[model samples]
Target: MRILSFNIQNLRLRQGAGQPRLDGARDRDEIGEASALDPADRRLSAALLAEAKADLVLLQEVFDTDTLDWFNTRLLPAAGLPSYPHAHCPPGNDGRGLDLAVLSRQPVQLTSHANVTPSDLGLEAPQPGLPVFRRDCLMVETGGLTVFTCHFKAPYPDPDTAWPVRRAEADATRRIIERHIPAPSQGLWLIAGDLNEPFEPDAEPAIQPLLPPFSTDLMARLPEDERWTYFDSHSGRYGQPDALLASPALAARWPDAIPQVLRAGLAYEATRHRGAHLQGVGRHRPHASDHAGVLLDLPGI
Candidate 1:
């Protein structure tokens, strides 16, 4: 099975006086005015997904089920890709309505852990009684593979203040995985999503509980220099927030499977990636997303 994980930045569908329109791949904070390239941005986003041709696509930052459905049925076919008959987007904790979504050729069983609080998992909460996950940890089971797709809290305005929340989220995720899979080391599972890890090299990682001895980092199979999947256009900094972490058994089974980071949809401003861009991708506005799509080809379930 070829699985793809992408953070299609803030994909929301809005209805105005005319036909409905999708939001561009930019945050409101980035620009004071609406982008003229909203259509171009979504087209590139669809184009990149078409190119990947993944059987299972895990997405982050989608608005809701309606948005996912419209994109799957309309934009996907318009981009010369077949519609994903099965798509899911459960409401998450994001205040802006940015949610986790999935698109798959085959049917999938999805469960949401959006309301799982730190107290429920026996973990101390950073903000008492609130959900541990910043967004949601969506569990998708398909073709005998269980995938825990997450969109962790970003290390934003203050990494220091954000640390505890992310740490609790990581710890909660670990506990959830442990409860679901009796022996995760022997299970056929993987965690795929934008972890939103801090970019500072020396800073302690909040996602440590989900790394190494617990689950193998599949991105590590690539050369260190090639592991980056996210680009900060403002700071001109590159980071590897997108991850495909596999269970030890799964990683052992596919020892040579390295994820393919598709950057064709990125903007020209992300110059560190001296590669091709999708047609019409401009300096920043007309782009698929700030983050590249990460694809993993697991031949068999």
Candidate 2:
């Protein structure tokens, strides 16, 4: 089975207008015309995702259930996908009122849902705040495989102060996943999503280890030349942030379950994401997301 993971930057593209329409006029649920509803951009992202030929999709930064419903109904159908029978989306504090979502062509068993909030996860940062403010995990079972979708906190400009905050959030996520699979023989477990941290292809850090006795980052198994899931629109240089991690047993069973990065949809034409002041409504520009999508192919059992 093929699976795709992406953070669609709330599916709001930057266009002739710098930002999206984040004014108070918009309600709790409104996604269209955030950039004039560029039919081409919307169709292209949806098509690129469908081109993966995936049976499952773990998506983040989607506006809401309504927006996801719209995509599944209109966008994906336009790309020749008449249906996505299974889906799960829990609202998040993306600030702009977006949330994390998942869509699948096959049946999905939502085993668990956890809001990794500061209080819920027992994160100890300081008096002011905890590690992650708005993050959640959607753990589901499908096709004899356990899947978890996460959208980690972004490593903003402040590395010394806020970077570790993001790292702490990731650490909390790691613990949550680990709690589910104490031993390696639990089952086919896979984690995928926009992990804002940079994975040093050569050396895996202890704080964020997703390999060996625990799990292996499927992306690292591919040739270096082909491992990139994101590009800095401002610099035009490519990198890898989105990823997939699974157990050794699962890796052995599906040796060909490679992590493929979809990069065709990472380009900014006219709009720039300078916040609500410079831009208008959204955070990143319209084309795709600040980050590209990463997919994994799990052949049928």
Candidate 3:
């Protein structure tokens, strides 16, 4: 099974006067005056997905089910890719409607942990009684693999304030996986998503609970210099927020399977990657997303 994990940056469908339009791959704070190249952005996004041709696609920052369905049916076909028969997007905790989504050719069973509070998991929330996850830890079971797809809290406005929340989220995710799988080390499972790890090199990682000994960091298989999957246009910093963490058993089964980081959709401004770009990708606009897509090929899974 070929699986792709991508953070399709704030993919929201808006009801325009003429027809519904999808939001560009830019945040509200980033847009000062330049007109959004939404159509071009989505075109590149679809193009990259078409190129990957993954059997199971795990996506983050999608708006809702309607948006996912529309993109699956409309944009995908236009990009020469068939629409996935199984697509799901459950509402998450994000106020802006950004949610986790999945697209698969095979059947899938999905469960949401959006409302799981700290007390439910016996963990202390940064804020009393609040949910541990900023968005959700979506559990997807398909093709003999139990996939935990998540989008953790970003180290935004204040990294210090966001640390504990992300830590709790990581701890809760580990607990949830252990509770469900019984013996995750022996199970066929993996966690795939944009972890939103902080850019601070000196600070301790909040996502350590999900790392090594518990799950193998598949991205580490790449050369250290090529591990980055996200580019911060603001700070010009490159980070590997996108991850494909596999269970020990799964990683052992496919030790040679290194994830393919698809950067064709990223903007030209992310110059660290000297790879070929998709047609029409500009300096900062007309791009697929701020983060590149990560594809892992697990044959005969």
Worst 10 residues of 1 by lDDT: 27-36
Name the 10 consecutive residues with the lowest summed lDDT in model 3: 28-37
C-alpha local distance difference test of each model = 0.90, 0.63, 0.91
Question: Distance from true position, residue 185, model 2, in Å?
Answer: 5.7
RMSD versus native structure for model 3:
1.2
Residue by residue across 93-137, what tens digits does model 2's lDDT show? 566645678788888877433445545555565532433545566
What would the per-residue lDDT of candidate 3 be over residues 169-202, giving only the tens digit for each residue?
8999999999999999999999999898866643
TM-scores, all candidates, are 0.97, 0.77, 0.97
Best by lDDT: 3
Put down candidate 1 lDDT per residue, 1-301, tens digits, no spaces: 9999999998999998888999989987866645678989999999999999999999999999999999999999999999998999999998788799999999999989999987888887656588778789999999999999999988888888778777788898899999999998999999999888877743568889999999999999999999998888778899998988999999999998989999999989888789888888888768999999999999967
What is the alpha-carbon lDDT of model 3 when measured against the actual structure?
0.91
Better of 1 and 2 by lDDT: 1
Q: Sort all candidates by lDDT, best to worst.
A: 3, 1, 2
Model 2: lDDT to the true structure: 0.63
